[model samples]
Target chain A: MTEIDWKLSQDIQLLRLVTVGSVDDGKSTLIGRLLVDTKGAFEDQLLSVRRKRGPAKESEIDLAMLTDGLAAEREQGITIDVAYRYFATPKRKFIMADCPGHEQYTRNMVTGASTANAAIILVDARNGVMPQTKRHSHILSLLQIPHLIVAINKMDLVDYSEEVFKGIRDELGAFCAKQGVHDLITIPISALKGDMVTVRGDNMNWYDGPTLLEVLESLEVTDHIDEKPFRFPVQLVNRPQTPDLPDYRGYMGQIVSGTIRPGEEVIALPSMQRSTVREIVTYDGNLEEAFAPQSITLTLNDEIDISRGDMIVKPDQMPKKEREFSANVCWIGDEPLSVRKKYWIKQTSNLGKVMVSGIEFKTDIHTLDRVSTSELAMNEIGRVSFKLQKPMFFDSYAENRATGSFILIDTFSYNTVGAGMIV
Target chain B: MSKRKLTQLQALEAESIHIIREVVGTFRNPVMLYSIGKDSSVMLHLARKAFYPAPLPFPLLHVDTGYKFPEMYEFRDWFAKEIGAELIVHRNEKAIAQGMNPQEYGVARCCGALKTQALLDALEEGGYDAAFGGARRDEERSRAKERVFSIRDEFGQWDPKNQRPELWNIYNGQIHEGESVRVFPLSNWTEMDIWLYIRQENIPIVPLYYAKERWVIERGSMLIPFYEGMEDQLREGEKPTKVMCRFRTLGCIPCTGAVRSSATTLDEIVAEAAAARRSERETRLIDHGSNTMEDKKKEGYF
Candidate 1:
């Protein structure tokens, strides 16, 4: 317990990953194995797992039990919701979301993948490229995850044959290619036997690719969000109005996209009142330039009308300011979508009443088909048109994930019922 | 322009600061749940940074169990004054008058009355619509599935099955009149991140986190701190002895346990923490087995 190098561990970068596959495809087991080998799983936790279900051998304990945390999930032996797990090595730190693989939990998987930089799609080697595998890949592609790792799990069931692994890999590889997945890595792994996960065991000597952990650690997490157009969604306007600083009116929020500096010409949305950035302020000090994800305050040269739930952006590259738009939505509420119902659309710093104008088509994820459907039921993905009460500043989700994505809140329940991405 | 990528610690810090500001911007009345632990210390530091040059918009609420370590009380008072923050301390006097002790009523009943019930009563009295806690998702199994802005019902109960979908960084903070939101700014932070951040920011925490020679008694696998005048609580054939130990987590006195260690400095402690194999909660008496935390959370335990 005393061999840890603090200096080396502290210098690691952060990576966010989501694991997706079919039910009983060993998604939970792969994650559990990674956590255990990295020393993320404590001895007492492993002991408790063993105590719950006595293991025939020390290595055969049910690793999935470590993450299927809910009472119902434990009773049913299935992951009902997404569980976020953290593990770190000297090279990097990871914030991985263990997503449910059941087809009914597709909405949950989408929720988990919304913020993921990369995704690990688990493919059962015994059953190569199942319908669920294709469905998961389609979702990941639609979400625009930068990197993907297709771990061919249960290699031992196929006798760790290189031909079996290659055949499955090529089948899934071609499928991902059609989906325009640029960065994909395929590895043969036995999640149950702890082979080709964190370590390169002799059983996988035929496989020369990096282990699953290595791909996760070595993958570049460059999203280039700052390179996109500047889009700042003002969360709050700071007017502390102290005695010393009587007239300090600064707009405070996290920069969702692009970089901004003092003396930059910008305009607040809806009002369209133009002004110049006087100062970019933060707790540290005034910055020459501030980029995406950095929460800071800004003081403009002109005292225009601006408040919460408003967007600030450059004058040249304005987002689409319209009340009507088309989007792809994943409906998750128990109650299906009703055109008559009025829902609150919460986009980047903007909230307004929205109504379903029309339903274009619902996706058949298994075959990647768009079938015309009027009703958007639970766990269904569909293209829909919405008419908002007021104009909202946004970009295509493909262009700016921070500004293009939104959620639908049920008016009465106040629960987030649907996730939407602008077309 | 080519931008510099933030290290893991910096990224986590920014995310937490953003969350802290969301509470101030969204809720009318909010209070920070200060437990005086390492995580709480990190949270307090972030709150100050979130609204720098301006004092914290919300006050800190500390629910005292009346059985916390003496060092925790002193640190709590001193740290609050140091930050120039308004600290509200509340204790369940009725539960104390009824002679509610862990030894007498067991860990479950005592924690329910002292910790869970006291927290609910304090929030009600404060009328706080949003309460910021320092719970992390990586600490337990059930917590891993919890959202950043977890909504609690009128009675402060958490509905695990029907949690709202927290997408990206945008949080839906809308709630009913009686409902409240329990926000965890450090939901993504792990134990390692806490120590790394403490070292980076040079935040001050309780001295009990460092190794020290103190009177202790061996209780099962945990080392229970044996203070003077508590001899009656000792079991048969048990005697207090001086030992070098430090607490991995702080909680109520009778239930919390200390670990044997000699890592006094922050750097040494970080190394020891990285090397430790057992979970930190294993030392606490309240966390007996799985599902205990989930059940207690349903009844409003911080």
Candidate 2:
């Protein structure tokens, strides 16, 4: 078989979204508004759902039921996990992950927002910006979500005052700027009364920003950073020395960064095997080139012993494959992550059994303080050091997130114990 | 300067690959949960491509929700042969004989008892550390909130409130003794995208999804196929509808509903599916309860 390359596209086309803020910040309500206002929900489906829905306190439509579709979820009257919503505006489609505000489900928010591009941090106009607002915004920035929208909800509760909206928006603006947020858009709306949802509101004539749905539609979502270097994480080796194509020996992987063209000079990681790209094959058809996040199988002109767990990149520029590194981690398990424990580390396709060699420090997410610790307990976000058995090809998490991040798997019963972003 | 654009399939493929790598690296013996639904069919296709030329190192696990359509079994048997992957089927014959159905114990209880509970038992019995599923985030609220590497306790219960932090694209599959991870490779693929993919790839699916002539009894706005013994339980008051019906989704013979349609080809199905803004889960009355999936997940449901 000829070497085939699967290039999904040159640009990342999907948008990962999330709604943040503290309890009763109307995170759920805002999501409901976005989905409903966007006309993303079918009329028949909506009607049926409404009819079957349990009676709310005042016979009002339980908008939260739109996202909190689970039984235990509606019973609690609070979002407990990440409820993902798929909607589309005329501009682009989006996957909006609705995260809970309770401190207990902070980890869920982190998970949901990690892959998000834009976060709609709901701020109650009555309460202004609270600690949870700061905490969530910081987490979004840390996760490298490109855009932030501080939604001042419950405008009606505050009598739709331009002063209330301005105050909340300005406070958020200052804080986010200090936290390094560049694209913070402040919007005013009422989730209960459906003001400025699908339609702009006459009540808030002073506020002239795009509607929440419009923001989602018009958000600038081109890939962050430069696609200067081509980096592919080797997933599998395709060697079909069969009757069809005996000489076929190819390395398959998804390009984590940059672009790769056929006949381009490339180097395989660790071994640093230099070769020219022989071919790029894809399912739709063959392409002359490919880019980050696209899955492809590539053939080299030379017969190099390339295998899965190895990274392929341009010979001139390659990633730093290191044995030891520090990372900010969100502890997931009930038991604390002790230094003595051996955890399974997966970076791209490479596998390395690792141990927490040292406890560098932990981040008090709310305060941004680094605390020295040898262990991280459940629901705690911290920093730690890991010693690996084998060197892993990685970039700084901030530089190339897809290649630089990894998860620590508990070897024993096999549950994802922790997720780490390489520093 | 500009945010990268992510395609529907591209995002799904990346997420799936990430999950696959996590399973291979973390678990001792991982298996793919195959229900032979369009989702599972798409999942298996993804798994094959994920570790291509390696003959997919993991086996396939099918928890027999005994009420599955016959065509599903036909596809399952054929797919196993075509792909040459190991397949394991888990059936709770006791529940079948006792007739522990959705009508009796309620949809949640029935699914929880037969499908969810059966899955947990089978995993423990097989000593499989992880079971890769085709759950999409858009399927349900509980599932949307799930991590790619979802963890289950010794009893195999899912706690959405206290899930691990999943950062970057990295998925941590870690657990204590007896605990396992329910890995979802298609968490990002939407229903429309899956249909688009199936049409693009020409992935053969069960005929149930297409418009065809079949004997069906209408039960609660759903056309439950006339399976043996199931027909007798058909509500005496209602008459069966024999329209050229196609299923928007395939669930157990009981709860899954069929929409009246004459679209027989994949293109026609795509057109029909595109028009559908409602989720397939909505078609299944058994899961309509608010937080039902979450509750069942808490009770160790897949």
DockQ of each: 0.68, 0.34
Instruction: Name the runs in model 2 displaced over 4 angstroms.
Output: A1-12, A42-59, A69-72, A224-226, A237-250, A281-287, A301-308, A321-346, A351-392, A406-423, B1-6, B82-86, B97-114, B227-231, B288-291
Candidate 1 per-residue lDDT, tens place, B1-302, comes to: 13556678878888998898888888999999999999999999998878876778899999988999999999999999988899999889999999899898888998898889999999999999999999999898889988899999999999887778888888899999999999999999999789988988899999999999989998777799998888999999888889999999999888889999998999989888877899898988887833388899988986
lDDT against the true structure, each candidate: 0.87, 0.76
Q: For each candidate, what TM-score against the reference?
A: 0.96, 0.86
Candidate 1 Cα errors over 4 Å, as ranges = A1-3, A6-9, A55-57, A338-340, B1-3, B289-291
Q: After superposition, how far is residue A42 of candidate 2 from its true place, in Å?
A: 4.6
- Candidate with maximal TM-score: 1
TM-score of chain A of 1: 0.94
Candidate 2 lDDT over residue span A333-422, tens digit each: 667898868888877777679888887887666566788876888767777888888888888888877787787777764556777888
Clashes of each: 0, 29
Residue A339 of model 2: what lDDT? Answer: 84
